[model samples]
Target: MSGASVLYDAPGPKTKARNRLYSIVGAVAVVALIAFVIERLGAKGQFKPEMWNIFNYADVRNNLRDGVLTTLEVFAVAAVLSLALGVLLAVARLSDHKPVRWLATGFVELFRAIPLLITIYVLWVILLANRDALGLSGNGPQFWALVVGLTAYNGSVQAEVLRAGIVAVPRGQAEAAYALGMRKTQVMTTVLIPQAVRAMLPTIISQLVVTLKDTSLGYIITFEELLYTARQMSTNIIVNGSDTYVPVIIVTGVIYVAMCLALSGLATWIERRGRRTKTGVAPATAAPAGDPATAADTGKDPAATP
Candidate 1:
């Protein structure tokens, strides 16, 4: 029997009908809940056009712009650093040396076990304490704290992802590399790393999206990132005698969703490109026009015989 059949039998007609009905009922319930929320919000004047009008103000727009730029800056730096760190950690974890293996394992397990928020908070405190000694200026301390915390956590996760991919690679590939007189470092760098990255690209991008979203955590350290700026706008701005919290939240949420969607789209494009990439050994060079070994292999000169 197939594995799926062993797990559970295929649903009968009655069971399938029941499942369809359940899905319909669940969908109706969700729609009703959404309608109810809309009605309530409408009654409270939260859907008023004026609520969204705050974005028209130069100051509000500028704040949002700055917030977005800052968030992207942190994400870009953290993503690059995290990927780099992940590669090193993954290689070290797979090292023959017991010390290196143990160190990488402990580091990955330690950071991955700790909550990301706590890590960011602790780093912020430490950086703040020694800002002068580190030559941190302006938002330097907050920025580095958030970036480093993200790098540590996401890098650990990515290391495990890469390690899984590396392990999944056929053992023959490494054996072949060794047979060709490739050193361990050369085999890893030129052979293993590229394949592991290609195989694990989607998971890596997903982790990067998480890293992007987590930039919002910088707000806890009073960093004026997009989410932080949005929070301020939501609380401070008023429209029709109520704080513009709902509209601000909705707009901010939309922006965040758009960003994630864009990232996902970019990842999809890259994945498609990677799939289309030429791979495997190059086609053997055409036997130099009239080589005798080529003729012998073919039982005659291919050019003359065929």
Candidate 2:
């Protein structure tokens, strides 16, 4: 017999033994599955030295580097645009006016319900048709289409996440701001939105990761982004009478994973900093000439500062 938590009862010795047995069995099964996969891959010559030799070439490395650069470019642009769009949509949805709220709701629902790939394809067609008028050249149309499409979908999701965070904030804070004669916009921008952003940052970063992966869809629009470049390389490059697709795919997948891990690590670092550092203005030092430094020490009274 052992201590039990509030939510669940503690397992007895027999139950713990059973659980350990199950875990061992599960681990063995997973190991066996991995071994089987490696054996199959070995039979297919996927790990052949010649397949990996292509990576040693300068052109191959440059092609992969270009792909990674393009992917990052799209992700950066889309992340900024999506966050901006989310802010606008969230504000609009929270608007006092019925028309504005309804319009924002419709826009969000429409984009959220539409498949992202379809959105990208449709936008690509429209952009391609008006390329000259839009001054789009080379991969510009595909780039914008993918970027805008990612913005639309991710923005809608981020809007919902932010809205939830905003609503989660204590209602009294907004009322206090209102009591202080602050306008709705000022209250929202200064008090509400900041709290909302801080609360929903993890969700926002997760969505940004999704946006990063979504860049791969640019291949459908003929955007020469990382995945597209890798695909082309795999199709063209031959080693020992076999297309070097496995190596290309493995390398491309690793790059994507690395990029995502880096983004997650960055978000984690930011979250940690946000925890360690205080928000808003730093505490004022002792009052000049001592008009009661008590208020200055506590940071409670603005009039106490010189």
Candidate 3:
């Protein structure tokens, strides 16, 4: 048996048999539940050819394509802005200055505590109300509202993640840097932040995935994103005397899953690349004050060196 089994006694034959039995029962129950759901959906004609055929329409396909593009645009802007804001907030929170740390803490806490949906909706309303004064037009209000709300909420979460990663670094590394006469800013930027980023990359990317998914909230403000477009298509399209809501929803949900998986894959690739790269500080060496080599380099004899 593996040493890890010391956490608990190894299972006896009877225990193993019971575990297998439980697993089989759970699997059977899950299969039965899925079968029941499929039967009901089929009865409702959701699996019919006509229901699934709506996606073949050029207009529907164009709407989905445009929706995906818009979603990607909002996600890209929000992800970049949020990461920048997160780094700033994290640095501020780590500052030796008390007021700056407190202000950063307050900002992070406030946004983290608020509901993201409400934040987005409120921003949308405010932007729409002041559209002319803000020089906003077209989908500008919806886009900005979604982007800013995502930035605020995800930025706070990422700040916490980065702070935790920084704190997790060994104190010895910072001490060594200081011993080399490095300033706090230099140590943080050159040593701490790089290590922290590598350690917290997975968490940062996960928050970004949440930001992408949250773009669906734009539907509430009529931003014409994937979810909003799906709703629009479902409502307007009739298939075999019924609405094509299920098929449209299924396709939209699949698209979301695909995008999130792609983000995860990208994060994994970056993590692998980081692991392959060299990290940490290189030690500095100094010659003894009276060494012959040092004295010769300085054009002075060692015996005559002060």
Candidate 4:
């Protein structure tokens, strides 16, 4: 075939140069867009010191702290419960029993299908409906409503993450575990989960970030989270020369971004540490079997069954 017409030919130098030009143009466009946004917000007084100075007020400070605490409270509770529920749901989905699998499948699909805000609002209304009979008084109903809604929504998401993680683990691992006389449960808990968790740690953490953000939905029910406090402060404060609402909203968003970034960094650290371990265990493992060279360099024979 002629060089110009050959299907197997790599891109010509001219084509490669053109592609590079396109990439450069795209990058510049993105950078310009970001710069323009920053400039616009600055022009609107969002970045002004006077606007943020409201946060220095004692009332503002206390309200923000309380909001942060309330946010953390719901996040911690929902995270633990969601993780537990997710594990159970994941295991059930993988169960040999058809009924258990179907039930888990339905539960995961049902909650995940609904909007998170709707779920929280529905639970809040339900609690309000039977407050006396359920003995849920005062903030009890609201707190639990938020907690359960977050759990149901986030738990479904976590279940899908875990299921995908489990599937990503080499099938050979589960088979090997079975060959070693491990029951399904033992293989799953002891073998699959540890490794799958490491493999899917990022996704799990991402779902947790979603859960953290979803806590803002609690504001609709008057649960008083960080966003709620920000909105309240924005409404109550009238800075002499600034857009208080825009500034406060930006600050609140930045706080959420910072927290999520920290969590993501933690996940990245854990993942790297997991990679350095021997048996996919903790960082302090005595060996490094995962590294083929670690054994060879140390003059250890892996074939020796000691």
Please report, in order, the local distance difference test score of every candidate based on alpha carbons: 0.87, 0.88, 0.88, 0.84
What is the full ranking by lDDT, best candidate first? 2, 3, 1, 4
Question: What residue runs in model 2 are displaced by over 4 Å at the alpha carbon?
Answer: 1-24, 268-306
- The superposed Cα distance between candidate 3 and the true structure at residue 147, in angstroms, equals 0.3
Cα lDDT of model 3 by residue, 1-306, tens digit: 677868766779998998899999999999999999999999999999888877788999999999999999999999999999999999999999999999999999999999999999999999999999999999999999999999999999999999999999878778878988999999999989998998889778988889999999999999989999889889999888888899899899999999999998888887876655422111111144543333343443232322
Prediction 1 TM-score vs. true: 0.82
Per-residue lDDT for 1-306 in model 4, tens only? Answer: 566667545769998898799899999999999999989988877777787777778988788788888899999999999999999999899999999999999999999999888988889999999999999887888799999999998999899999999989877788878987999889999989997888888789878888888888888998778988888878878876443898778778888888888887887887777655534332223265664334443445343332
Q: Model 1, 111-203: lDDT tens per residue?
A: 999999999999999999999999998999999999999999999999999999899887877887898899999999998988889888988
Q: Model 1, stretches more than 4 Å misplaced?
A: 1-28, 269-306
Task: Give candidate 4 misplaced runs (Cα > 4 Å).
Answer: 1-50, 241-243, 278-306
Which residue pairs overlap in candidate 2's backbone?
Answer: none
Residue 272 displacement in candidate 3 (angstroms) = 6.4
Candidate 4 Cα deviation (angstroms), residue 304? 18
Q: Which stretches of candidate 3 lie over 4 Å from their true place?
A: 1-25, 268-306
Which whole-number lDDT from 0 to 100 does residue 145 have in model 4? 92
Instruction: Give candidate 1's error at residue 42 in angstroms.
Output: 1.9
Task: Estimate the overall C-alpha local distance difference test score of candidate 1.
Answer: 0.87
Candidate 3 structure, TM-score to reference: 0.82
The per-prediction CA RMSD against the true structure, in angstroms, equals: 6.6, 5.7, 8.5, 6.8
**Which has the greatest TM-score?**
2
| lDDT (tens digit, per residue) of candidate 2 on 1-306 | 444455565879998999899999999999999999888987999888888889999999999999999999999999999999999999999999999999999999999999999999999999999999999998889999999999999999999989988999878778878988999999999989998998788778988989998999998888999999999999999887888888899999999999999888878887877665433222334324343433343466444322
> Which is superior by TM-score, 1 or 4?
1
